[model samples]
Target: MSLRMATDADVPAIAALMRASVRAIFPRFYDAEQTAGAEIHIAHLDRAMVDDGTYYVHEDGGEVVACGGWSRRARLYTGSGDRDDDARLLDPATEPARVRAMFVRGDHTRRGLGRAILEASERAAGAEGFTRLVLMATLPGVPLYTAFGFAEVRRVDVTLPDGIVLAGVEMERPVTAGRTRCPPGRP
Candidate 1:
């Protein structure tokens, strides 16, 4: 379908798509509690797309089928990438944008929506004067990000507030440096 900036009207469908995406994608790398925790967490984090100012969505027939976002983050932030290289290798003056919270609805899988969201996010980052963009990828999402030229910086097992553990890969792509110049799969 068609990608666009997320608006207030798409919020509910975006939330449902986020939950379904996490519930479906996280299971390949985690267990029942972890999956449930992540699903619940997805439903809880509404403001991520709010004041953050860079939320985006792909809508079809007025329904949000995909969503993702990027925000200005401190280079020292640890949630989105491999800690060893990402945290240690980053300088706030250098990499100013981090892409987070990407979700594609379950029914829309394998349709290149993931790739589209990523490229769009990268373009947004570049437009914002950010050269490097970082993201945290669930196990299944790792390959998709990898295929888009995001190099792994680290892997982490994060414990939620409820003590449920979920693992993800941290990756970085240099969108403005001409290093991350891959094309989307297809429309």
Candidate 2:
């Protein structure tokens, strides 16, 4: 498999992959109702992420299998079906870079794809002088972020368009000189 920065042309494939991945993987942690309820709100690909060059996609056999990225912008996650001040530039001196939109193909789980993207984002953000990284972790993404040294700061209840609220965790980890320590055996 190969990992590369995502381009605008990759958005459609990325969105499909995100939806497939979430539908297949989230059921393990969420019920069918909750899974279906939150799918649309959770699976969209924000074109701005690609435009900013902070998003990435993993390819295997010429197929995009996993996708994710980080951002200097203020948006923590996309497709929440709400309006917020997500376009503001973060103060890297005081705020952590936002580690947004991460997903892997369900059949491709347990491999290092997610870890690879996470590390790439951390390195990219660190290169931009961001000393820390933060993201809103879906129930299924918690283990991956935690394995990457992110600690849960709080639980956030996201209300979807139809009023179905899904639980998420806000997580953060410090970045030091373009390096981070992943938990042993996580990848």
Candidate 3:
């Protein structure tokens, strides 16, 4: 497996992977309408992350298997209605870097892809002087974020454009360099 920075050319494949992941994994935690809303609103490509050089894509055997990123911009997550300051830059000293869109292929879970991506994101954000990382994680993603040291700040219900409410967790973690190491015998 190889983890590398994502480029504009990878958007189509990344978007497809995001949708597939949501469709495959969301059913366990959400109803059909919520799942569909998530697929439409949550499973999207944030081109700004790519342009800002904060997104990453992981490939296994030459196929993209996972994608995620961190951003220093004001946007907390995608698919939420944009705020007036959404495009503004954040101060790393005061604001935690936003851990943006993360999606692993439906067939690629339990392989450490998510962990690897988080590791890269933490290191990069830390290097840029960010002291913490924050994310609004879907229910399916909360376990992974928790395992990676993120703690829940609150539960959120995002109302999609179609008026469906998708539950999510707001999570945060400190950006500790080299802190992504797994425990003994763990993958």
Whole-model lDDT per candidate: 0.69, 0.87, 0.91
Give the winner by TM-score.
3
Q: Over the stretch 15-59, how does candidate 2's per-residue lDDT look in tens digits?
A: 899889989999998888788875777888878889899999999
TM-score of 3: 0.95
Candidate with more favorable, higher lDDT: 2 or 3: 3
Q: Who is ahead in lDDT, 1 or 2? A: 2
Tens-place lDDT per residue, model 3, 32-59, is: 9888888999998889999999999999
Query: What's the residue-level lDDT of 166 in candidate 2?
Result: 84
Native-to-model Cα distance after best TM-score fit, residue 25 in candidate 2, in Å:
0.5
**Per-residue accuracy of model 1 over 1-187 as CA lDDT, tens digit each:** 7887777777778778878887877777778887788777543333544455667888878778888777665433323233344323234357657776778887788898878877777776777677787876667778788878788999887666666667777788777543346646733
Candidate 2 lDDT at 23 equals: 90
Backbone clashes, each candidate: 3, 0, 0
The residue ranges of model 2 lying beyond 4 angstroms of the native Cα positions read 184-187
**Residue 27 displacement in candidate 3 (angstroms):** 0.6
Give model 2 RMSD, 1 decimal: 1.9
What clash count does candidate 3 reach? 0
